[model samples]
Target chain A: MDPSQVDVPPLKDLTIDNITDNVKLINSGCPDPRLKYLLERLVQHMHDFARETRLSHNEWMTAIQFLTSVGQICTDVRQEFILLSDILGLSLLVDSIDHPKPASSTEGTVLGPFHTHDAPPEPNGTQIAHDPAGEPCLVLCTVKDTEGKPIEGVKIDIWETDSSGKYDVQYEGREAPDQRAVMTSDAEGIFWFKAIVPVPYPIPNDGPVGKLLTLLKRHCYRPSHMHFMMEKEGFDHLITALYLRGDPYETSDAVFGVKESLLIDLGKVSAGQAKTYGVKEGGKLMSYDFVLVSEKESRELREKNAMYAMKDLGLRMKLYNGLPIPEVD
Target chain B: MDPSQVDVPPLKDLTIDNITDNVKLINSGCPDPRLKYLLERLVQHMHDFARETRLSHNEWMTAIQFLTSVGQICTDVRQEFILLSDILGLSLLVDSIDHPKPASSTEGTVLGPFHTHDAPPEPNGTQIAHDPAGEPCLVLCTVKDTEGKPIEGVKIDIWETDSSGKYDVQYEGREAPDQRAVMTSDAEGIFWFKAIVPVPYPIPNDGPVGKLLTLLKRHCYRPSHMHFMMEKEGFDHLITALYLRGDPYETSDAVFGVKESLLIDLGKVSAGQAKTYGVKEGGKLMSYDFVLVSEKESRELREKNAMYAMKDLGLRMKLYNGLPIPEVD
Candidate 1:
């Protein structure tokens, strides 16, 4: 049929109330049902947002320009859009939805932009921080399955900011993989490392996102935390962080990455007591136990369980329409 | 007060249900009340949209990438963001809201990307289309006040596509300002020009916006029309178009610029009959009359009237907060 000749109802003049439906109708031809659904909802909500706010033309233009700058500033190493998402708390929301953990297991958080796959593997108890000015600290972690069985030989990736709250990647003259290390758990599912106690610090604030934060009169600080990525042969890979309980920004982490289960106490240790854990005097000690859900159970829970049954229903609708299903991973 | 010492309430873990409130609280410090309201509303609606669609991480990433590409491709001559907005019907929606015309006045449409301020002025009946292949067209227009009194000495900027559905800007070898002309209405508020009968043309489809249209199984064609920017003393400047009735894409204009009042008949004139208007034989004739509201009424209607009282209220709030209010013009 000649689409142009088909008697389409004449569109009413553009209005706040009708614009959403009009845009949805325009996107009705999208072959990808998922994209169509996403776009329709986006248009509906965006139009509603604009109307509800009584957004001026200038405000809308400002948003367009801001988004443009964000896109223009993105590079291989820098993703301003992702940063925007993270600071907006969208990244963490997505993380939680995609990786709902059982009550017995550790919760996941955003895999922040700084994770690198090239950290050198070190034996247990190796010092990951070389900065002598940083306060010495000892971290011990044990990985176990939901049944409380130790998951030995799991590869654990660990990284943390320096005591000054700056990651190695943020330094202009830092060596490769500083303040980061990879290790395999021992027979007892125990992995320990010596490092500096990280301090809360502001995120990079020199770009457009920074300018927006300043305009909002908002601080850009993230709480002190240690990042961990643990993987075992038969368990779901866990990417999370353990934040220091008493950190100044613990209750207000900029990225909303903090979870009650992920907070740990940083116990101050005497010089002689620190020496027992192979750390220098006046250091801190932290011990955490991470529980992983089995891969089979995790997959089944996401695909067939009631927690995500709505998503499953959506996927089934897509399949019924003979559209290609997008890979969740 | 020491911000860090101030006891902030513990944040709930990020979830779909609470992400909106969380983001709103994060933006609570926004000194500019207008920006805060807009951003808060944006966050709420965007979060709601994400949840309503059960948007997957992959789909979200795809959207970010798509927006990034749109921003990267924009240049001085090309505005992909505007194109995106236009294709989605947002530009027209904004225009309609910002420039609400009374029923007696000619409605405004999009100020399309092709408008240039450098169009050379010519006397009435000047032949604007230099292309010999184009069918001759005679445009006769009258400008008037809302009461039908002729308003003389109005500058009318006119432009349109050639018979081949290509604008001068779209042609690599075209002369400067071809197919465009500026003219002034005479003492009687009468204006006339000779040009080609414009053909429906596809918008530039080589960019990300075009790709999006294709993915949506939608066409990018706009109906045959002549753009006009009419300005005179004591009246609001008007940016609008007169679409040729019976055009193939008149009902399906990709930009949603068509209005029932803007459609006009193009009566074919024989060579002998065309001499009356000083046009060559085998041309089309279109007579349109535009009515303009007084500037006083327009301003008062937009500001003090209930239709836009909410926007005025918002403006007052911005003023009270000492934020620079955006210029309505």
Candidate 2:
């Protein structure tokens, strides 16, 4: 044993009951308090879960193999781990924990695996739907603060699936980006672009996560939606999506990413109105005003919510353990 | 939504508190009961762990990346996930759960990442060590049942690290096996071989698991030990190792794999006996009688223990949740 590890108590004759404590004790030597806390609680839950389930050796090996496959499948353009996290509802849970917002502000969601930094900058009203797979729609969106005041110059990166239910990145040997673009809000906090109506699509399921979903008998399709990643100075960057209200998968998005506030209805725009945007006739118009929280407000909310979340968790644990929940007063 | 999914109620407008239930509900459609049970508990613990720690976005991403790297570093011969599980004490827990035995049987330990099926078969009394880095040692062993009767023709696979604390597999472009062999017990249920004195070795640490141990201020060395995997018809197969009695890392095996029953003290053999075994004058000797449990008995013990474990776990959970623990009849 190294001299640096002398502080960690020696672990010997480990049984099911004492193993977690010994592991945590060994991990207690970490220099960072936050990291130490995370490790301790992580070991606690992992061990407890194993014991509660009385997990068998075969099951554990299966989990190991599944995880290995997930890691092996990742490439420069793909992130299978994030996909696993999303299907498990973990990605959204973490996002919610970190990005609590006011009721009026747009709720954040899972930044699915398809976003890219190379989205070409386009002028307002430029057609982003290079592929003719679906009906044309003109997106008219505005960025605002909680006070409903326009916040100009916000860079919004937008991407979505075509009618075939696949992102441009999903195609093999794809030469150019389609149905995606980066656009900036005008001085009036408004940005509009021509795009195809987004369609419901299955996440990449040829990997282990896909196999898991199939075995779980769960569909892999997410509701038709347009992804938006907005960034501007002095405000919190937002990763969100606007789901079509009438989509069949709206109520049961495979990833559990749906939030009621992010749903929007599409309206018809006449040929004359559509022509003003330089798109073909009989196009649909989608409009929404997204509210961005200031970075200061986001930080304060995160801290406050973290405290509340821990307290609430402690109370649940107390109740579950048969201990009395503390009085709020 | 597919017609088959009508049984799974739609999940809408998910909140943090309700997402777990929704995820479980969707997963309830899995046809395999055992798999369904495993997934339920897995999600329960994973979510509870995240919530209890109030796991941050940064931390979650860190975990994802860590797992990815662990997966990516693996090769045909290297199993990093097993190493991760060993360090977390999960591998031992699962092993204990699946292979419960009578008190008289030899205890089992981790089957580490280094074992290979390609170990060349060697005759009894042959020297298995091809590397000159370690001191010569004579190993004498016998296989027996709980009733004290000898069990013949037991296949024993033996392996150990050289004095430099490296396995033959650890070296790049290695051509042949060294310090490892497969031998079978004779008609008298006895097997003898000449080998090297095993020494403590750190697990492969150039990867993420190593970095994690370093960050946690934990040593990565396992106590010097000789590996053994024994098998014979109609008896339980055993995977175990014998640790040296006074190895410096005995008490703090980085993987939490040490158990008292498996420790042994080495003894020296006289020059005459060493010559009989065809080893040098100063060679050490290791001797032990291994006991095997019948397959039927092992199956029974596992079933009985599994019931007790689940019952105990249920009681603990009930108490923790403030519910009354069930009375034993």
Candidate 3:
């Protein structure tokens, strides 16, 4: 034995009881306090989960391979990881935690993989579905503050799948985008648009997320719904969706985006009543009122802005540090 | 109001307390009981971790992007996901749990990312290092069963980094593989090889795992050590390494592959003592004896074999089911 090395300590053997602490120690040097805290908790939970499951080495390797496939399948137009998060109900959980809405305001859901920044703006009552193949539905929506007062000029960005349950992006060789529009509320905070009744649609199922759902023996269909992102200068932005009543998948949306307040009745209207809104006979008229919450205080607004600025700076640093540019929208 | 649709149940709101249950419910349809159990525990821990950290939307997105990058960077030659697991101390934890050694047997560690099937076989006492780069070290190891009797004819596969801490794979244009050899134990269960003193080396640091280590302010160097895989019929395979005592990183291996019993003294030997092993002048010698556990009862072995067969069938089904081929090794 070498005397110089005789003083070396024996390796601290790791066990189920000690593994969490060992991992925590490994992450103790994280420079950012928040990052450190997150990693520590993450390590703890991950180990606990593994132990609780008695995860075999083979199972763990399978998980690693699954996640790798999820990442590799992602493209400029697709985000399989985000889809995994959605189906796992993580997306909604995060959204709910981040944006706790008052009872008077609209409930939020996931910003499912479809939102785009360059939505075409059109006047109120414009027909969003250029060539409708489903029942004509007239959407009459009113935007209001918590006090029930009108909050005019709020931007309401909307998008949905067509009668065939396909987004414009899903179609090949499509000439123009359909089933989407951006419109602003009027002086009365009332907005209306002509669109087909959005049908229940399966999320992109050819990817790893779909395979996971299949393996889990779960359906991949989301309830028929219209996605909406309502925003204004002072109010908090709301990313939510209105699930149509009577949709079979309403009770079990694969992405779990459903909420009581977000469900609406698409009641049938008389031909005369439909004509009043420029809809053809036998059309449906659905009326919804979205309530927004005003900014709480100047200091709170300033803090929020600062947080966003910090996030932007961190993102820039990550980019400058040679991190891969994420293709997320 | 649409009376026909009035019977739908109210959406089950998800709170921090209920998010875990919601995710569990989503996975309730999984046919495999083991998979269902694992996913339930995994979902619970993941949600708890996120909630405990109060992870913000931006931070969550950042994590997703990080994992995506890790998956994207993996290739047949590299496994960024495994590297991530190693740095997080998960790989060792799993290995320790899966392979609990008896008190008399040698402890096991991580296989690491460096093991290859193309290692050249050599005769006993063969010099693995073709040229002089560092101080010569002769490794003499014996294989045995738990009874302490010699177990000959066991394959002993070995590999390590050169004196400069560079593996043969890391070199741009290597003339031949270095610091690696495969040999079998003789009648006395003894095997010997000559090679340069293995030096501590940093893991591949150009990938996302390296970037993560940097972000965590953690070093990426593993302690200087050797790799070994000893296997024979009717006995468990042992994948482990011998850590060099007194190495600076011994106490803080980046991959946490160190164990006290696995640590040994590389004692300096006199020229006279070295001549017996064909070493020139001053040299070092390391003597290690690996004891493997015998296979359990026939019932246990049969059960294990059946479980593995089921896993193989599942994997084949997954492939035939149109899941993307994973690019990870």
lDDT of each: 0.75, 0.82, 0.75
Candidate 3 chain B, poorest ten consecutive residues by summed lDDT? B317-326
What pairs collide in candidate 3?
A: A11-B260
Best-fitting candidate, measured by TM-score?
A: 2
- Model 1, runs deviating above 4 Å: A1-16, A112-139, A152-195, A229-237, A267-286, A295-329, B1-14, B112-139, B151-195, B230-237, B268-279, B285-287, B299-329
RMSD, every candidate, angstroms: 5.8, 4.9, 9.4
lDDT of 2: 0.82
> Fraction of the real A/B interface contacts present in each candidate?
0.41, 0.65, 0.44
Model 3 vs. true fold: TM: 0.80
Total backbone clashes of candidate 3, pairs 3 or more residues apart or in separate chains: 1
- Mark the 10 consecutive residues where model 2 chain A has the least summed lDDT: A317-326
TM-score of each: 0.80, 0.92, 0.80
Candidate 1 local lDDT, A210-233, one digit each (tens): 888777776777788889999888
lDDT value for candidate 1?
0.75
- Chain A agreement with the truth for model 2, given as TM-score: 0.91
DockQ (0 to 1) for model 2:
0.49
Misplaced by over 4 Å in model 3 are: A1-12, A118-136, A171-182, A267-281, A284-286, A295-329, B1-12, B117-136, B168-182, B268-281, B297-329
